[model samples]
Target: MYRYTDFDAAFVAERNAQFRAQVERRIDGSLTEDEFKPLRLMNGLYLQLHAYMLRVAIPYGTLSSAQMRQLAYIAERWDKGYGHFTTRQNIQFNWPQLRDVPDMLDALAEVQMHAIQTSGNTIRNVTADHFAGAAADEIADPRPVAELIRQWSTDHPEFQFLPRKFKIAVTGSPNDRAVTKAHDIGLRMVRNDAGEPGFEVIVGGGLGRTPMIGKVVRDFLPEADLLPYLEAVVSVWNLLGRRDNKYKSRIKITVHEHGIDDIRARVEERFALLRPAFIGVDQQLFAQIKPDFAPPAFKDRDTAPFDQAYSNDPVFRSWADTNLSAHRAPGHAIAQISLKAHGATPGDATADQMRVMADLAERYGYDELRISHEQNVVLPHVHKADLPAIHAALKAAGLATANIGKISDIIACPGMDYCALATARSIPIAQEIATRFDQLKLEHEVGDLKIKISGCINACGHHHVGHIGILGLDRAGVENYQITLGGDHTETAAIGQRTGPGFSADEIVPAIERIVDTYLSERDSADEAFIDTFRRVGMTPFKTALYGESDKKQKAA
Candidate 1:
């Protein structure tokens, strides 16, 4: 993790003090709600449906034990006893009082964390692969570049306010764990013919009312040119993106209106001008940041305890099978702690749960923690020998759900529960689906599936890329849920196709069950996942299953 320097500390302190003054003025009637909106947004504060919400950024999803403990403390002292981890790998405190926000900010500053750029039209938190340095398949760790981008963009005068919010995601692995394709700027590290690692830069990808898989603007860009190239891309879009209509303000829309070729040409032109200004300063900073992300000194330990537990305890076996990923270090595993436990809200962790995870990370995980974009906490470098003890601790904390990438491990946004822009409730729907699948005991049977739910067309839950995507909307004051199938968020990214008419809230869960049952029956073998089956068989079978034979016949005719 990147430690904050004196300059970093001073910068955050000054920003916090400014926000404190701004908060005081708002309370004193010096600034009205409308007047304080932008200021508060710049600080990552939002006036939600019920109360104020504060979003704190977790850069590249990396956290030290002390930072995690501070977050738990903030959750307990300022807001509700739980904080919601978001799809962007940030945390949201939903019940913070406006008056106490400054205090909360101060508390976060003490831990070298801040809420800045977590929201608003500027670049949000620069996300990377959660398993950046630990993933066995990584080309190189992407965190140093991510950190460099963060430092460059934090308060850049040119990009403080863009036409709309922009997001950038980076992944060093070939497997695409970061969902790089769905970001404004997606950087996938790849090796050139010379065998040097570089980035495959993808641009114009976004999901909302309009979902798009980013186009590869550069097949291979040298690692040294990353910062300048990124600046060129954003700079071109910042000037060309629409400001007349908020609906079409994103870079995705801009790229759609102008051909990718034109956009590429313009970015190249801009790069030629900006490259000199950035000669080698960014690379120098990147070199400095690289040491902070070096791999932990892993111990040569026996895996006998892990093997014993897997062989003896079915519970531990199930959890280890589902929640663990291969680690680069020998006898090490990546442990994913599920927040979506049965009926619990997805991406939420209680203060006690947070503390438990913090303690486990300190004890067994080399004092490192990561927040996955899938709404789970990751102990990226846990030795296999520590698995039994860690599993026991997690089970006691209600965090040991063996449902990673399973049907019950859903990704859902706050929706109407907290968001003012939501049309219907997403949290309850997610809870119902997870609970229904758990009760049926078919989650493991259903296999690896991603069910993403967004309360509206905003796609905050990334519904557009889910294998079974659910979009909740209000139709004539009643909640209607729409379903999309075959969407993928991996390297071969594709936007999901809608299955046809929306279902009532009562019918949504059953509809999902029908889709799963249909997949099970139609798949060539048990090994064929739902997505592969959907792709092979197309939407006819699932559509017939969802809309009945009569509707299927009607469409056929």
Candidate 2:
């Protein structure tokens, strides 16, 4: 919850003004579509298959009630009546009129938010663990470092136009809720032997046509040397990364082409040269930013209401069991509000739903909200006493789906429905899967599953990291969905392994069902999760379940 300073306000105002003029020129025929492409992209505008899409950054996925309200207002006023929360913890307005974009930008600026660096080949929004400040196991909050990186990367002269887009994710907890290993630069906070908090830096991890887990470049980077070390990493990659081919332009590919050891050596060399200039300036800025994220003044109260509801109401109990995470403070919980209600779009929230969440945050959640990378809204610090009322409000708003980490709680992208680059539709596939599982009443039975879907090989939906990953492709002229098993997004991150062949769109849901049924039958006990079963048994059983035993035997032979 970093408040915008006068300088921050002025900077955003100036950028908005500049973009407003740029948008005006494009509308007036002063610039052609091709001519204005990069200009619009720089401002987080995309001309999708049908209309313009505007992506607004939510730095470290933190938002105030006022900011959330303004986002709801923008969604209702300019675009459709809803906004899509993305895997990067940003929101996308999918159907904005070209002329209204500047107005939307201006409205976002009013709340100290913007869409800058959300697109194009520069560093995208710096993301962190959604439970950064509230996670019970965190060494320290990662948002201060995330915000510092955001400030340093925004419009940086040297990095404005890198060979490809870059992403950085930080997690304060060792459990890695932020999927740090899949980012260009992943910072996992850790305490050294001397008890000093530092970062374990991972580099070269990315998912697209080529998916690779990031390598540990720096086992332990001191907090003070973070900025300089980060600069050195990016600088080395900027020079070494491919510009000739966009496919190989990412730093991950660069890291792959050059060994991690060589890359580390180069980064260290660059760090030696760059470290002198920083001289603790970044640390000073970080110190100033850190206070803004101080823990909210939590009220100590009896949890009698929550206890009563949990004991009496099965509905409330189910929601609480699924949606709540342990908080750092006593008598507090982190409540995850599901956007993926059964049969609904995975990451979309209606304006009304947004307002309800904003109200709940303001009234019961210490006036703060967080957007998790899993496409859920989080009240990072809510008293357990308020669970019943909060659950009631969410139920009324169609947000109380007790499916967090369940089979129905999927992560998917707006595939062929909106994205121009998509090959097949992701929304319908996700909806069908969720609805199918819900109708069968097997979500709770399935337990702690992640099913991620992508429209194409771009992996925008992060299918590479899901326990059951679905990648929708256009096979010749038909929509074919491929499945990957055993992928994990936690501390032991691994790219999913694909099962043989692809299923028709009609066969995809049933295929998923077969996979789940296989897990249930093969697991040693009910306590074993789908991921654990997949890992323990390996792909042999799942492959036989997906493809036939004949095909499994064929592969073995």
**Positional deviation of residue 434's Cα in model 1 after best superposition, in angstroms:** 1.0
TM for every model, in the order presented, reads 0.99, 0.99
Q: What residue pairs are clashing in model 1?
A: none
Write down the lDDT that model 1 would get: 0.95
**How does candidate 1 fare on TM-score?**
0.99
State the displacement of the C-alpha of residue 199, model 2, in Å, after optimal TM-score superposition: 0.3
Q: Assess the local accuracy of residue 99 in candidate 1 as a C-alpha lDDT between 0 and 100.
A: 94
For candidate 1, lDDT tens digit of each residue in 211-260? 99999999999999998999999999999999999999999999999989
lDDT of 2 by residue, 317-385 (tens): 999999999999999999999999999999999999999999999999999999999999999999999
| RMSD per model, one decimal | 0.7, 0.8
What root-mean-square deviation over C-alphas does model 1 reach?
Answer: 0.7
